[model samples]
Target: MPKLVRDRTLPALCPFCRAEILRPGEVEGGEWYDFAAGSCTCGAIFAHDPTARNGGAVFLQALLMVSGGDMDRAMELAEGVDYDVGYVQKYNVELHRLEPNSFGTLYFVRLRALGGD
Candidate 1:
């Protein structure tokens, strides 16, 4: 059986809103850490982990960005109760494709119900 191959010229979609995501830019507020980050129309935040091994860091960055630098709040929020998480695995940003042999990952986070909301 032949391995499936996906077209590499298409745009990537946001996991939460399904909107076509624009290529990420250097994230603000954390110049110390390098991340290609962006937000969706539905309020979901995303960060690309090129090496796929920095998912935890990537997730933290996304969470922090979404929460407006609230590290304490970001860490306290529960996965399903306060927010939701999703991943685009084997993602290749340059080609914007889900390459089967790649090791990149795009982490997504969306707040479900924050305090007083």
Candidate 2:
């Protein structure tokens, strides 16, 4: 495991609500074998992609979290209508900063109300 370092100047934040985010932790009973994840106060779930590749898996993890681990429910929802997606690229999980030229990314997913309200 790599040592985590924080950037004192800028704090990592949630893309949806701009709230300072907590460090990613092991997800309990998650779908994948091993993954780091966290959530924001505004109901957005995020998955850390250290390589910035595997975005599809990261996104699916987040969507599944928001959908209560229901893959069918997660797949049936339409983007922008049933939910919204946001991401912070160039993220550094160890440093907790959006470093320039980095390849890490944090994929976020927030579900919308079903009534079209």
What is the C-alpha lDDT profile of model 2 across 1-117, one tens digit per residue?
A: 998986444567888779989888789985561558888888888988889678998888988988998889988989988899999888777877777767888888888773235
The true-structure Cα RMSD of candidate 1 reads 4.7
lDDT values for all models: 0.81, 0.82
Tens digit of per-residue lDDT, candidate 1, span 1-117: 999985554457888777888777787666634789888878888899999789888988888887887888888988988889988888788877667777888899899853225
Off by over 4 Å in 1: 1-10, 114-117
Local error of candidate 1 at 108, Å? Answer: 0.3
Q: Best candidate per lDDT, number?
A: 2
Candidate 1 C-alpha error for residue 68, in Å = 0.6
Give the per-residue Cα lDDT of candidate 2 at 43: 84
Give candidate 1's error at residue 58 in angstroms.
Answer: 0.7
